[model samples]
Target: MQPAAPESAAPAAFSYTAFALSLIAGLALGIALGRLLGPLPGGEAEPWQLRAEDRNHYMLAIALEYHESGDAARALDKLIALKPAGDPLVALAEGACALGSGGYLADASGIAALRSAVQLYQDFGREGCAERLLPEAAPAALPAEPPPPAADARAQPTPLPSKTPPPASAQTAQTARLAPTPLPRRFREHSLRSFCDIARPAIIEVRTVDYLGRGVPGQRIRVRWGESEDIFLTGIKREYGDNYGDFQMEEGVEYAVDMPGAAEPLATALSTGSCYSDNRRGLKSWRVSFVEV
Candidate 1:
């Protein structure tokens, strides 16, 4: 009886505990992996990413600093990195770098860059900067030197065949069309100063309102000077003002501002009659309110 029947082992109960543990582990792993590959907190972008305007402004600063440091090569590199290769500011910087690279205005690259910058500035309503780069209109052509007094045939030295072709200096001068010439140090200093002057910010403000005296946002303002016109939009800039936009105005220049929604265009006089204390130098502005025509 004791040996009776080896008690049949009770069928092993299905392990719910093990199955639950495995499922929990899988879920934990999935969560960890998702977090590891997920985007950064706050969904932020790479810090290195730069906006076009920001990049342009940064390069201008670096280029200007390099010019002052007399580091022409570095200045040029900064300009080359600038976007919109056709930007007048970039062209101006390139021209300045070329000129400061011990070539003065004789440097062909510098002259070309300056010419391009001048045209772009004109097209962009930057007359002050453009005017500075343009050559004086109708500059008198230099008189041609009289032909070398006819050398007496007897006085001319007989040409002797040389085994070696020519001196290195003479060969270089003959082969290279653009030889680097030494520029006076003072000239570079002057050029850097002029660049600073031209590149400095001269902020101009505009505010638009409707006849009901309500601020008008998204109004397009066309600023005209000389033969150039530039359009900008109005927005609310914090406490600066609602329906406001700002532009940089060249010193001592007048501009005509037209708003399509306004009854009439506003013309800036010698004095806009309104100036503000802004970080930018020579801050001026115009306040326009539309009225029933």
Candidate 2:
């Protein structure tokens, strides 16, 4: 029977051609599918790709320019593009713009937003900025006198005699012409002594470091105390230790802190009452540092 036609022999030429065609068809199908799908939205240039410091600087610059130029609408538009919707810094900038633009001043929400921004800035140690955002106090109105009791129909008006000053003598007039000498005003120099007076329990120091244990600047640190929350930007005055984060804490209350851009946030807290009181504490603040591992 011709040795059963060698059962283990390779496939025919047609089988090889079929296999080659199948492989080619699969590659073509994959290419067509890829083209149909296209790239994902946002593509490779994603928001997360931006460094935190760069983003903050960019936003702050835009905010400052808007603050100077009084271009509220444009500033708001740019801020919206940056997506700092819930960020207090951006909110402060927005409030400044609104105050300049005049239109938003009448809106209740706008007023509330500015107030919130002020509080946020104050808590975060940006008191100067907060003060700027604060609205000017309205002047108090004087009480109006009641109209002369409707002309009493029966009562006759009485005229009162007025006293006139006697003619002044030449010597008396010369004395009157003399003005009191102006007194020199005393100026008090700014001092941190008041800050030093706070008790230790009320002071807290914060610092930040990178993976190398070196100081990190331009960090956004958020602290929560009881029902209140505050946020501060690090490195404003590097001379006072740019990486140092200093804040006052209420005695007996606990505080929690975190850095916004940290991959693994180094959260820490303190119970103020646990520490000893120091008379010089106000001048000396407490400190905490976030170190990347």
Candidate 3:
């Protein structure tokens, strides 16, 4: 079935930059790279490289995430020894770099160069070139120093005020039980960074027909995000299809809202790989004003 059009109350403006991820998975590389790159053990870049070409995109991705979250210090630290990216991922990095630079990304053309980098990698059939290049990195940090000798070993440590007074394990369990469980959104899944703050909320379910209006299971359903990009979270599980339905969403999140005359929340959210994806088309992605209980 066709997915509804994308809509948003606050249109998210971002660069459509792409980058070559290492043929290696991000999780695998984090183990050693953290130390090798002068960081605490167990961090980003899993399945990381000990080779060149493979290291570029994954490094770029790490840099981008840090840049977007406004952690310039960390992002710069990662890119300190890295080379300028080529193709596909270069564009992706450019977008993240712009965000890292502390300047407003007024429009999509904001990081067009970065997007081209991702395309470059793809064009060369090195979609995930696994290059682990390490021409040189700064020297590792010094080991931590031992604590200073104390005046009296027998003295009891000063009592510290508890934060929130520690909750009893039993009480904590009870509170968890009382909280509303997040019913799984069967279609929630994403490949790229899905923007939870900007998207349409109209959730669409697709079902195939066997001549009867019954339900068709196991059909490929496409939910496109917005005009800015042709991102569609495709090949969803069929169980959720029968309910081509509406479900209320958490407030302060993006949604493809339900059509007033339609069955559910207007397809008001964009598609996250997991329920909502962030698509920036330079339109009205926000509400002028509205009251809600």
Candidate 4:
């Protein structure tokens, strides 16, 4: 009798949180750097003298373009070695990238986020726009706004609730409980917000191809994930799936698969998130399987 064949390893489960973050980081880095350089969608390889016309989004798009090729880990090296304060695109993409890379939102605050966006907007208009977008009075941390007091005349001044502080024991217990939680094991690590952030820095384009070495046109492949029943992000798979894999990218959408072998999906199944990704790139887990003619 023939010897039994070795079983294949089970595919790694994909983490929505992890991969999303990678893409975010990748795009942000790429954009920030590209913007610092100039006119980068396809203009010059690395623009030196920055132009006044360069938008904050230009470089971010470039980074997304970088991810279009997939492989976040590789893209990360490019991001780590950057000096991005001078350019607006660099700043904004870097901020959003935290979520795209999908692990930790890191230490950036909401005020920082709005400030970055505002700064870029300022570049477009003048001091007026900057005043509105990034107001001088804005708090550094920019905590959420407080609720307004009631205006009804009939509403007698209700007795204000007394501030009852928690017992010292309770406070100490809470602190102790939180202290033992490690960085990787925290609940915040697994949230959707963090996941999307991490993947942003890691996503690449998903192109399609056929058995032959020619570009496959107009074929729509669905990107489904094995980890969850939901489709990862199903969009019109790219047109230039030849060099890449059967796929094309939608603008702004990034694809990420922490689930190794979760790459190069074979068939579409309902369950995972089904939608289009920015038509630029994707990362492959499974070997590309071209549709046979």
User: Which whole-number lDDT from 0 to 100 does residue 80 have in model 3?
Assistant: 45
- List, in order, the clash count of every candidate structure: 0, 12, 77, 86
**Per-residue CA lDDT of candidate 1, range 200-223, in tens?**
234556665554555555445667
Tell me which of candidates 1 and 4 scores higher on TM-score: 1
Candidate 4 segments exceeding 4 Å error: 1-206, 226-289
C-alpha RMSD values across all candidates: 19.2, 24.0, 28.2, 27.8
* lDDT over C-alpha atoms for residue 121 of model 1: 28
* 235: Cα error in model 4, Å: 11
Q: Please identify model 1 stretches exceeding 4 Å from their true place.
A: 1-202, 236-242, 267-286, 291-293
In model 2, what lDDT does residue 176 have? 48
lDDT by residue (tens digit), candidate 3, 242-275: 3132232333344443222111332345432333
User: Predictions ranked by TM-score, top down?
Assistant: 2, 1, 4, 3
Candidate 2, 270: how far from true, in Å?
Answer: 1.0
TM-score of predicted structure 3:
0.15
Q: Residue 145 of candidate 2: its Cα lDDT?
A: 42
TM-score-superior candidate, 1 or 2: 2
Rank candidates, lDDT, best first. 2, 1, 4, 3
C-alpha lDDT of all candidate models, in order:
0.45, 0.49, 0.33, 0.35
